[model samples]
Structure formats: C-alpha cells, structure tokens
Target: MYVCICNAVKEKDFRGAARRCSGGDAEQVYATMGKVPQCGQCLEDAEDILFEERQLCTRLPAANACQGLRGLAPA
Candidate 1:
C-alpha cells in the first residue's frame, strides 16, 4: 500500500524505515528515505503505519529474548 504518494513511499518501505528509526518518528522515517511529506495528506496514514511498525519492532526483540530464556529455564 502506498502510504506517502508524494515521496512514493510504500507501506513496506515505511515499515523498514520505522524499524530503523530510533525515535520511531514519522518525520524521521521520511528523512531517512531522503524524502519529505508534501501536501500533508499522507501524514496521518504515515504516522499510523509508523506507530504500528514501531510497536512491532519494540515487541519483537523482547519476544525473541523471552523465547531464548524459555530454553534456559529449569526443566
């Protein structure tokens, strides 16, 4: 799905940027891609995608750590 038409940014690309973004900021995502939000129409959707991706990124590391710990537990 095209999240930012102005910059030709797709959802997948945005998700990658979201994961790479330390602050999980929408603007930073755009900046990382060497693009900028124009017309301001895609801001909301971009932000929404960024938020969802950021949430997933944050949880994934912890989920993986938990899985690793599960193997270490006393059996």
Candidate 2:
C-alpha cells in the first residue's frame, strides 16, 4: 500500500493528505507532506486516489438519496 516509494509514504497517508488539499493545488500536498515524486511512477496512483476521493465528495449524500427525502436536507 505504499504510494510514494521515494518518501516511503503509505496509501492511507496519501488519502489523508489529499483530503487536506481538497481546496488547493495537488503540488502543495506533495510539498506539505514531504512527498518527492521520484521517477513519477507513483503519480498515477496518487492521482487515482485523489480522483476517487473527489468523486465521492461530489456524490449526493446518503441521507439525500433516500426516497421522498431528497430535498428535506442540504447535502
């Protein structure tokens, strides 16, 4: 589950970092987390995780998906 071999960062760590960088550039995430992208092999993996998180965040909230309650609350 290692995401950045150069920095010895784990996938979980990357996920957390991505969440924190939700409103900023991804490069800032790398810099703040001290993750150096050597050879760029892990770039795709990092981006994949970020993209997945972004997709999940954009989806309708679980409570909002319930029938007859779609507009009862804010997402």
Per-candidate TM-scores read 0.74, 0.67
Q: Give lDDT tens digits, candidate 1, residues 33-56.
A: 899898889988888776666455
Which 10 successive residues of model 1 have the least lDDT summed?
66-75
Give lDDT per model, in order: 0.66, 0.61
State in Å the error of residue 5, model 2. Answer: 1.0
Candidate 1 deviation (Cα RMSD): 9.0
Clashes of each: 0, 0
How far is 51's C-alpha from truth in model 2 (Å)?
0.3
Task: For candidate 1, list the clashing residue pairs, or say none.
Answer: none
